[model samples]
Target: MSHAEIEIERRDRVTHGDYIAKLDTSDSTAKLSWTDRQGVRHAEHTFVPPEARGKGVAEALVKALVADARQEGFKIAPDCSYVERYFDRHKDLSDLRA
Candidate 1:
């Protein structure tokens, strides 16, 4: 499936300093964090079930995370390898990198 075909939902747990972008099913989540000091957010982990592979679900999640960081005036430390690579390809968003 394409990015447009996936429905990604953001669940924010501000009390826990974490957020998750979940696919329609609960099985997959791209987990992120506000786990660091200095107001930085971390893109920590992305999990796509085998059935969801190649569907752009993970990319959609990270894109939403990046968008949030941009709008919310926070920088991102992409600890997840996928997110790191995504940043590498989109250097235009480097200003948001921490």
Candidate 2:
């Protein structure tokens, strides 16, 4: 399905240090962020429900996180395996890696 077909809902809770992108269905994707002693944002975790698998939901989440990192002038530590593999696939985003 196209990205348009999959509506991603965003919830930014800075107080909790979490940025989430969720689908209309029960399936949702989320990225957890934390700041280091050096004052850098780290993308610590990404979660995609089983039903949302193979639908590019996780990629979309990572892309959103990357975009935020770029706009906010922070680097990503991609602690999640999914985000790590995503970085491997998208070399262009290497500049955002921390």
lDDT of 1 by residue, 1-98 (tens): 56776655666666325445555655655444445547887777767766666767777878888888888898888888988999999999999999
Clashing pairs in 1: none
The all-Cα superposition gives candidate 1 an RMSD in Å to the true structure of 2.6
Cα RMSD (Å) per model? Answer: 2.6, 2.7
Give the candidate number with the greatest lDDT.
Answer: 1
Point out where model 1 deviates above 4 Å.
Answer: 15-36
Q: For candidate 2, write residues 31-53 as lDDT tens digits.
A: 44444435456667777677767
Alpha-carbon error at 36 in model 1, in Å?
A: 4.7
What lDDT score belongs to each candidate, Candidate 1 first? 0.72, 0.68
